[model samples]
Target: MADEDNPDSGGTVIGYERELADITGAIDRYGTGAPSHIAIVAEPMAGRTTLVAEIRRIYGDRVNYLPLEFVIMDSTVLDCSTYEGDIILIDNCQFLSTRKIGGFDVLDMFLRTQITSKKLFITTWNIHSWQYLCSVMNLDAYFPTIVTLNRMDMPVLKQVILSRYKPGEIRFLDEGVAERSMFFSVIHSTMRLPFTSAEISVPWIKLNFTLMLRKLPRKKRVQISLEDVILEKINRIAYGNPGVALMLWDESLKDNAISLSAITETPFSISLDTNESFILSVILSMESLHAKDLAAIAGSEMDIDRVIYRLVQQRLVRDNAGYYSIEPFALGPVTDYLRKTRRLW
Candidate 1:
């Protein structure tokens, strides 16, 4: 495959490029002198992991990736003096937020260790948690560098999709299949600015684009690139959630052409009338509650366990500290409905 044909090669590296450059510079500055830690703050789905992967690609074995997701240790585990490395990449530091053990504390401890030792620390966080910590705990002093992942524009999104298609990956679409206007429409709608997190958003964009292209009819189909259609839909409905968008597009592929109606009818589609109502109710009852609390709230009227599980799947709510709460953006409608109809007060 030509270098550009590889999506990873020509993908949306723009946003993180400068940040990574800065990190590399920081590492070079401190790699031999002293330990330095950098914190990367982005919205969920904004593309943190990909950026990290890119960093690893650039740094190779010199960087030690300590993904926080799999680490079951608490706040104090960060304090353990046994850890020693030249570079530390800690992804998903926001997980510490829910533990009431903010990433700041963990990062603080880690940085303290790095200062005396010889290691570079880099961490990623969900933007929401970053702001919350900044406000509640004055977390700004912890990191000298904070990189926020910006969403891709039309051109970048187009490049990202087209780059994924090898001449042989699909025998369908014509060359230069993505149209500018259409591409703009799709990316603008699908890719959100100041993303909730790149870790959540990038995979979503990549997956949705691929799934959408595959669904195109081989011949006598829409002349438009499957990339365009998927991007458009992703722009329209998916926004911060590429996962849901991809899954919905997969459903549309059953018939080879997806319509808004088909999208609404998909089983995973969040039905405003039915599912949204239940989610709103549960969220209103428990502000910042965990998954089980959501189950408990809905348990009296509906299948609490099932509802909480589905809510998590829908991304309408999330589990923090074994508790569940509605996503920040989703809180308004849920709160309004609860006040008016459910009498949540």
Candidate 2:
């Protein structure tokens, strides 16, 4: 059967059988004359692009895809010229709505369009944006269906990585090693906060790392276990972000290793106990604080410059503009620690 007739057949749509089924079912009900679009949310490298590709392959040209990235403009001015179709896959729709622009207004208008027009639209957004949209702005009402792609579990992640290796080379992943690597991979993935831009897929970091690994001397390959190094570095640099991991791995080949030492080698590590307390205090006490504010909070004991610098580097906090705030998720840990130490309310 041609893809459009089936709407759920593709290699890229692996492990998402349920999501596919739900989408196709929705399409079948609403897609014949006009389609209803959905929102597919996932962390970076969680395979949003692949999902869009699968949707396109299944729906064929019946679906028009507009991949949105950093260039998210207002819906009022959006030119949907090439977007006339039964199904529209809007990848990285998060760019359209963020804290910078009044994302709520944009999302509100976009959702209104989906309802007024029977266009079956599937949008993929960063988890952060989705949370802000749904929780902060109460925009979840606009989305009839929402599917969140969580971190890949060990077994699944192992299967995903091993699948990339050819049958012959795949045997190199000793039983325990694959599982162990995946464990770390998942841990690394959780460290980086979730994002929603489906511009790339799982194998995003493939060739870059492989080409670099191949450059090693045959002797070093045997001694160092390139696979382990690759997994470790990929786990760290990309934080299980297949795209970023692959890119960093490739760059490492050209550049140098991005090891923990290299990351810490920067001249300082944030004094966790003291610095975290001070920083959190500043954030909680003030209406809003920036990196410079963090420096002030650190007082003379620690340099605010270094405190913000290190926290951002470690992914403990996010600095948007000059505003330095702990990442939304990371706040849990920081808050818990501070409370335990009698920091704040």
Candidate topping TM-score: 1
How does residue 27 of candidate 2 score in lDDT? 77
Each prediction's TM-score versus the true structure: 0.55, 0.54
Q: Please, what is the whole-model Cα lDDT of each candidate in the order they appear?
A: 0.52, 0.54
Task: Write one digit per residue (lDDT tens) for candidate 1, span 1-345.
Answer: 112223245333543466667777876787455455677875444566667777776776766777765323355666534554456777776655432223245545554565565556787876555665677666656666667665554344445434544554533222232322332232322333574322233333233444344457776334444455545544444343332333444554443444433444212334444544655553533244555434443445566666666667776677777766666444434444545654343
Per residue, candidate 2 scores C-alpha lDDT tens digits across 235-302 of: 44344444444344444332332333232101123246576566654453331355543454355777
| Candidate 2 Cα lDDT to native | 0.54
**Clashing pairs in model 2, backbone N/Cα/C closer than 3 A:** 35-119, 35-120, 36-120, 37-121, 126-196, 205-246, 295-304
Best lDDT goes to which candidate?
2
Model 2 residue 87 distance off true place after TM-score fit, in angstroms: 1.0
Provide the RMSD of all predictions against the true structure, rounded to 1 decimal.
Answer: 9.9, 11.7
Q: Kindly report which residue stretches of model 1 are placed more than 4 angstroms away from their true locations once superposed.
A: 1-15, 32-36, 70-73, 79-84, 99-117, 167-230, 240-315, 318-345
